[model samples]
Target chain A: MIYKSLLPIIITLLITMAMLNYLISHVGNEEVKALEVENEYLLTINVFKQLNNTVPKIFQAKACLLISNPINYTCNVIASNITGIIMNALGIISNESSGVVRYEVVDYVIYGINNETIYYVTIKALTPMGDTTGIVGYTYPFNLCYYSQFIKELMNTLNANFTIDVENITVVQSSLGNEIINRVKSLIGTSSINITINIYYVGVFRMINRSINRTTYLGQVSYTARISPNNVHTCNEITTLAGAFYVTAVVNRYVNNTYYFSINGAININSMVINDKTR
Target chain B: MVVVDSLVFPDLVITMILIIIILLLIVYVTNQLIELSMIDYKASMGTYLFLKCQLGNFTIHLNHVIITNGTSSSNYLLICPQLVVNGSQIGAKVYTAYVKW
Candidate 1:
């Protein structure tokens, strides 16, 4: 009689415990979901803020480059001018070279004050690399004008005065391998209006690997740009003004058991710039 | 006397069966709960570490001591010091230091 009386109470206790466990788990799952959503929202907001802050500065610096005259501009002078402009525009200088030809321009139909100004400007410059024994190349592309307008609008919104446009950019290599030339060309091709680049001094060094039977090795590359551009004023006004920049690259070749790494640190200069602008 | 003995044996057997079943259920549920809780704790810890790692200097110091084990281990440590400009790491260097354990 006692057992029968206790059966209902025991059953009720078991059900209650099960329901409590379920409730706790549901609450925990909800909390986890909430935390995940919060993290994602924060990350997105941060990225948007960064983009908002950087685009204007870049636009201002590039605009300065486009409007500046390139005649009688030596590589060093251009680099210095680029540095100054970049500094003034609150931008960082990455790399500069003084031994190449650089030309850039943009053509756009501007509608302002009930008048459309179709204007084009091309700034071409050339510099020598390392005692006249370096490779030379030129980059001239006409499609950069569209991007110039985009930069102008961006600058206007930010109340900044710098802008950049890519009119026609072309890079050629006389001493470096076709591979290296192609890589540099591809990098330039990927840019819109503002020019930001890191020029590395690369040399080829090889090591042997045991997997490929006889001997295999990977190449070593090193890059340094300390003396290039340290300040904004020097970076935008001078380095970029140089139009074309030069850097050293090395190549490695291996045959049989002999490891051959060539010191191809010859000077190579490539130029880029905006050719024209309409304000 | 026979009826009393029979009743006592059956009661003891039923009690033992019930106890064993209840113990097994409790063990299973407790194990699951503990495993879930540990997972949640690790997730929270990872998130905290990630945020802490963004503090630049703090992250570098922590990684130097913990991840690289530079304090008690004999290994070469490379420190790249750079100023963050426009959300970019610039003026970086690779310096090597030897730690003696």
Candidate 2:
């Protein structure tokens, strides 16, 4: 009689367990999906940083265009459109944009501290998931200039008195860049390696001597070199061009080619003060 | 023992065997059904928690615990790198650990 009684209890316990398992699973499925959706959302926002990094071999020059309104290029490409080339690096399938994935560049800020330049790109992506906004922070180990040979060489180019010959600055900078590039690379090939150093003149426009038919002002010279992965460090060595200049916020980025940063004596030469300070 | 006969004893042993088999079958079926329908919740958190960092401890106490909960790089060889940040992790020199919970 006791055995018969226990049989019913065992059957009842099995039934209870089955019911509990079904209830827990059925109820929890939606909760789990909801959490996954949130992760996908944040992942969408941060995907552009990845897009910026693995830029196609052909578009490297145009894509890494000298940091002037880079938000324009940074936010435009989505990894999904490339298909076989990039294959939706973030695994975004539904976000197709007529063969060209594009986004609205919200903000691009460069934070150079602790030996790094973080290319922080905030963009809004229009996908099948709707207008999903995200941020891509691409970092390169740069912005350390105290130990850079380039800054030391640049200062030597400027000489002991720190007087820059505004007339021949372009020619001087070009030759200086060539010399540095040769010293850094044993075999320098034009097709593989390309370096560009831009000097942004941010001063009053005044006619001075035989140097200019137009007004002249010495400005921030950003020494940025765009190097392929093959020639990465050759350009990276002298990337930190902020040591001996006035009014400089150098964006030394040959994408993936991390430039070291050194900003010493950040005093602006606003016409009157420049003459007295250089000597 | 004699009150229940030898014939009744065999019946009792058979019932015990049947009960064990039924219990095992119930557990196996229940697990399969649960596995087929359910998805587990996943969440990630990132932050810097100094030397006193705890792993498997609750990052935020919202009824459940979680993620990115340690400091001290392996080997502990580089002393200055290990001691860059104090209580305030202002410089971002100290890395923010990210984890799935």
Q: lDDT, candidate 1, residue B84?
A: 28
Question: Can you write out model 1's per-residue Cα lDDT over A140-192, one digit (the tens) per residue?
Answer: 22222333343333223222211111121111123333443344344334333
- Candidate with top lDDT is 2
Please report the candidate that would top DockQ against the real structure.
Answer: 2
lDDT of 1 at A28: 63
In terms of lDDT, the poorest run of 10 residues in model 2 chain A is: A263-272
Error at A55, model 2, angstroms: 9.9
In candidate 1 chain B, where is summed lDDT lowest over 10 consecutive residues?
A: B87-96
Docking class of 2: incorrect
Clashing pairs in 2: A45-A134, A143-A261, A144-A261, A145-A261, A145-A262, A201-A219, A202-A219
Best by TM-score: 1
Fnat of candidate 2: 0.04
